[model samples]
Target: MQEKLTINYTNDLHSYFENWPKIAGYLKGNKQKLQDAGETCWLVDIGDHVDRSRPIAEAFRGKANISLLNEAGYDFATIGNNEGITLDYDDLYHLYDEAEFRVAVANLHTKTGKDPSWMEPSWVVETTGGVKVGMIGLTAPFPDFYNLIGWDVQDPMEILKQEIGPLRSSCDVVVLLSHLGIYADRDIAAAFPEIDVIIGGHTHHLLHEGEYVNQCLITTAGKQGFYMGEVEIIWDTEQECITGKHARAIPVADLEDDADTAEQVAVYSENAAKAMHRPAVVLPDPMPCGPYEDSRAMDLLTDYLRRWTKADLAFLNAGVLLDSFPAGAVSYMDIHRICPHPINPATVPLTGESLEQIVNAALQPDFVSFPLKGFGFRGKVIGKMIYSGLTFDITGTEAKPVAKNLKIHGRPLDPKKLYTTAMADTFTFGSLLPNIKQAEGKKYFMPEMLRDLLLEAFQEIEK
Candidate 1:
């Protein structure tokens, strides 16, 4: 006799709630169909379901996302970087307290050598016919941020080496839920042929039809709940082995929205608006922000970053502030709307010469206007570089400024002297700023995002 099991999954939702109702509807409908056909089915999420860019997520610290997952009947899930490092350690530790599903991620642990009660290294499920399936979860190892947040994200390959053997021995088939992106998924599949299926996310690559690498099927749905992934495994009961496997990312855009889920989202949005309505500051005058020109708001934020981190200097992009701070009462929601990125403040030690190189690179038209998507930046462009604790003499035309005679504290910048400089965490990773990325002695401030610092800056100004 042949028995089949179906797994439906979503990844990289990133708190895009508009399409979630359709996703819930599709998953529920398919799950019911599989059960009616006498097949076992499971609903899973690969990760990145909670992104604070959405006001609902920011207000609830991801609890609302957990509620949505519960209502959708998710059976298993793992953590993406957004869920792992964006919230404080305490918040993440309790983020899944009320989750109805099992959370599995083998590599995440607290700094003091303890795992959260809700975390599982792997899970085993048996169908009605006694076909056993084993599953394990893994996330990206961003040590810099994770360590600062009081969590240690061990190497995924190392964790797999320890867990896969035990999982393979216990079940007829093994599955991997990976939040480690596409390149790592390919590598894991090639290295572990015993694993029958790998569901992936983080890079947001959509594989309309699953790809097979070394007899391991790899699949991923595109981000934001527009598509849902499905995998079917055919098990032969008489032979006690698997006979077939199929996978695809099914489109959910055309599905009808679940009325219950839509109502839940509305409630969450209303609650979030209320939570974020608290007054943050009272601005005496409107502080206008611009992408290319020097602005009071950008300068104030840059100066605040330098002072808050106690660095010798600070630099930030004008684009970080998305909107102007209107006169009168400023609310937390206003600040969140203007600076929604989860980027933290970081200080890196660089020599005067390296700083000069960074300034020169920032002055280039292409560098200033580059549209960056990742590295925790949720802005349209890099924009003009705003500086604090330093002055530059511009000798070129307005279109292309050439920075010269750089001075620090009323003296010429010494090329060989090392200085600690502060900036947004975005520049510390990507090719946007090579000198800062390669700089030594980097110290990151966590549990407080740039928006938090902006609030403090405003408070100081009000006082």
Candidate 2:
């Protein structure tokens, strides 16, 4: 006799609740079909289901995501970088305290020596036909970011090595719910031949059909909820072993919304609108500026960020200000709406050599024009890197700097003097600013949104 089980999963939803009704409707319908046919099935999510981009997610701080997931009957899940690093310690600690399903991640540990009550390392579940399946979860290890949030993620492979041993020994088959993307998933499969399946996300690669690595099968449904992944496995009861496996990305774009969930979404949409209705900045007139050119408001902000950190200089992207403020009353909510990104200012110390590298890198068209989606950047593109305390000697068609003369309150560049620079955290790590990468001392300002500095800029400009 042969018994079969199916696992359905979604990942990287990122608070895209608009399409969620369709996803829920499709899942509910398919789950019923599977139940009616007497086939066993489970629904899971890899991670990144909560992002601050949506008003619901921002207002609830991830609890609302858990509520929606519970309503849809998710069986298992894991954490992604968004869930791991984006929230403060207490919020993330209790983010899923009320979850109805299992939340698994083997590598995370709280710095304060207390584990979240809702987290689990793994689980053992039995199918209707009595096949035992073991599942473990793992998240991406981003120490630099995670450490700031008071959480530490162990080496992914080390955790896997320790946890997979027990699951492999105890269960007929093993599965891993991975929020670590395709590269890590492939590594896991190659390292552990005992694991039968790997469901992946984070890099958001779409796998129409599952890929095979060593003795394991890997599948991903891409980002958002446009597609859900399905993995089917058959076990031979008589032989006490697995016989076959298959997986696919099932489209659910046109599916009808689940009636109850749809109503709930409508109510939430109204609430979200109310949440977005607060005033941000009171501009007396339209303070408009060009995309490529600098504005007084932007320059003021760059100056504020630099001076606030006592950095020698500052470089900020012009696109950080989403909309120009008309001169009047700006509220916290208005600031949020206008400059929605969660970016914060960071300061890094660099020598004259590294400073030149930073200026040269920011001058490149690619660095200025790159469209950045993640890293808490809710903006369109990086735009121009507005500078403070530095003047350029231009020699190119588009004001490209031939020589950058770094100064302090109008002094000449000193090659030996270490200069601190305040810039977006996005540029600090990537090649966008080569000097930033080479900088010796770096300090980060956290939990402070760029809009906060913008408000200060508004006040300074008004004065």
Candidate 3:
């Protein structure tokens, strides 16, 4: 006789709560139907459920996300880079304290070399019909940020190699909840034949019908809650092996909203509004700012970046400041509104030649106005480069500025000399600034975002 098991999964929700009600409703409905049919069904999330870009996530420190997941009935989950690196050590350590579901990221370990009480390497679930399913979780290893945040994220492949053997031996089928992106998922499927199903996220690629690699099935639901992924495995109980597998990405946009979840979201939003209303600093005057224009707010932020990183000089994009700060009392919400990116400050060693190239390239209209989506940037464009602890003469028209006499602390720039400069960590990746991306030495300051630095800068300016 053939028995079937259904696994419904979500990935990279990223705190996009708008579509969550539909997702909740759809999952709840389908889950109930499967349970009533006496079929084994599991709800899983592949990570990145919490993103600080949203006000609810920022104000509640991811606890609200946990609440939503709890209500949605997530059986198992992994960690994405956003959940691992965007939060502080204490925040992430206790993020799932109130979670009703189990988290199973095998690669994540504390600084003391111990796993959190909530984390398990793998979990085995037995269906009513005597089918044992083994589930393992893995996250992307971002060592630089993870190490700084008091966690050691071991290499995913190594962790998989160590954990998969035991799971394969003990269970009838093995499933991998991977937050390591689609490419890595495919690679893992090719490398490990023991893994029967791989549910993936992080790169936000949607697989409509799932892809078969070797004998393994790889599926993803894409980003946000636009689509929900479902995988069905047909087991031949008589033969004691899996017979077939099918996967689908179901669109939930047309699904009815769960009223209870909608109310919960509203309550969270109201609470977040009240929480973020607390005063952060008092400004003397409104700092007029724009993406292309020089502003007091951007200058102060750049200065703060240099001082905080202890770098000889600092450069920041004007667009990092989303809006001008008004005079009088500035609330934390105001700061969050102005600079909401979870970006960290980074100090990198750059040769004067590279620095000159970076500055010149930044001045170009095309580069400055380039709309960037990822790499920790929540802003719309790159904007003009703002500098602190350095000065350069502009020889071009007001519409465009050409760097002329570039100087560091009253001394002319030397092409051969290497200088330590502070800037947003966003430039360290991507081709936005090739000079910074290729920098040999880089030190990233985390846990404190640019908004945090702006708060400090505002307080100092007030004093």
lDDT of 1 by residue, 1-463 (tens): 8998899999999999999999998888888888888788999999999999889999999999999999999999999999999999999999999999999899999988777889998988888678889999999999989999899889999998888998999999999999999999999999888899999999999999889998999999989888989999998889988899899988887889999999999999999999999998999889999788898888888999999999999999998989889999999999999999989999999899998989988998898889988788888999999999989887787667788999987789999999899999899997877888788789999989999999998888898
* 32-84: candidate 3 lDDT, tens digit per residue: 88999998888998999999988999999999999999998888888888899
- What's each prediction's TM-score? 0.97, 0.93, 0.96
lDDT at residue 447 of model 1 (Cα atoms): 83
Q: Which regions in candidate 2 have their CA more than 4 angstroms from the true location?
A: 331-333, 399-401, 438-440, 459-463
Q: Look at candidate 1 and give me any clashing residue pairs.
A: none
TM-score of 1: 0.97
Candidate 2 structure lDDT: 0.82
Give Cα distance to truth, residue 396, candidate 2, Å: 2.9
- Residue 387, candidate 3: alpha-carbon lDDT: 95
Model 3 bad stretches (over 4 Å): 394-402
lDDT of 3 at 261: 94
Q: Count the backbone clashes (under 3 Å) in each candidate.
A: 0, 15, 0
**Judged by TM-score, which candidate is best?**
1
Residue-level lDDT tens digits of model 2 in 1-463: 9998989999999888888998888887788899899999899999999886667777778888898899998888998877887777888999999998899999999988889998889989999887889999999897766777788889989988888988888899999999998998998899899899999999889999999998799999988788889999999999999899999998877789898898887877677667766765466656765456688778878898888878778888887877776667766656666677767678888777777766776777777788877667778888877888887665555645545555656887777778877888877665655667766667777666577788887777666
